[model samples]
Target: MEAGNATSAAVLQARELVKRFGGREALRGIDFEAAAGELVAVIGPNGAGKTTLLSILAGISRPDGGEVHVPQGEVGWVPQQAALYRRLTVEENLMLFARLEKHEDPRASTEQMLELTGLTERRGEIVARLSGGNQQRINIAIGLLARPSVLLLDEPSVGLDPRQRARLWEFVSALASEGGTTVIFSTHDIQEAERYGGRLLVLADGEALFDGSADGLREAVRREAPEAADQDFETAFVAFLHHRGH
Candidate 1:
């Protein structure tokens, strides 16, 4: 309850998280944590409940069982897509969301966000006109307008090019460095996780398979299954699944 020391206090924590859809269990039980200024990535294969876990943390959906504790002003969410109005300009969309949230300085924040997202030149362009990568950038900027201490990003690099993805991660790292924002993002791209995430959580069947540094995961794979050492993330992930089953 007492968030430990100011430096080490966890911005987000979930224990034994579970979710069900119809008769099937989407999440068995998941435990995750994000400390201040940490950039953690959630990696897993399809149907592994990565998105489901992120949704619960983002407050977009509730978990069937388990506890999620986040302090006020300590959370923000960037969904997979832009979620912007197709007819509205980028600036208009930001203004609309800010006003809906009843933020004190919607206009100023909107302006700042436009600058931050590199959308100043295209602020008046309809969201539908922007490229996919730019739209995603706007989505990230909108999420940050509230200046949350923790940020949850779900598959942010899905439609981005290599350059755009690199730029986005750079921005995220800068945010973490400057504001000490704890970021937890779900990624299918293992290379992206290796390059950007300070810590990695590999999930399988809704359970944490690995929770530690990327280097630690590599070492574990090497120790447990040497054959997977040369394989890429997807292959290694599959190997992990097979090894866990046997």
Candidate 2:
């Protein structure tokens, strides 16, 4: 697919983002964009800068170079960690975050989030008492408390059971499709990325190798490694990377 242009109507954009740690570069001039209601998956191996990229987009870390354009107070981020008040009750945690966001009605926002994340029944339970999956749900609920236009998830399915993962995807999918929210998720799971992303961004060694639909990725693999045409996606992807001298 074509790279995002300067004049594109994208809600979230990064222009030549660069990040470095000591002698190692975590990102090398990455350009990315996501429009409203789009599901974009970022797939890469460990230490390929997926986390660094997401952190930059979420404003958790400043990029060494480049600019990010996103509306102020319009972006929400759910990192791999459950950044919740473990001692607080589920409802209390949501209320606190909603108040921090300065929502016009923190009570209403908390109520909505409780229902949205299916945590109403567990609202009174202390956060530390919740299961891993439930804790993840609460974290995502907190992120959505203000109804952000852009949501960034970094390895969201980590430590989640299959059922929990399914539930999370269903909710996120609806948020992008029905709620008209832009969702960017990072993952190392090939199947998860291919299954969910309307578009995929493939990264390796801090470089963007490909960006497009799953079919486009397959076609790219077919062109780069003809023998991989009949292979599984993981095998074909490796072959494609080999051909690219990665």
Model 1 agreement with the true structure over 139-234: per-residue lDDT tens digits: 888788768888989999898898988889888898887779888899878778878988888876776777888777777677666788788855
The top-ranked prediction according to TM-score is 2
Tell me the TM-score of model 1.
0.92
Which residues of candidate 1, in runs, are more than 4 Å off? 1-7, 232-234
How far residue 37's Cα lies from its native spot in candidate 2, in Å, is: 0.5
Q: What lDDT would each prediction earn against the true structure? A: 0.82, 0.90
Error of 2 at 6 (Å): 9.9
Each candidate structure's TM-score, on Cα atoms with residue i matched to residue i, is: 0.92, 0.95
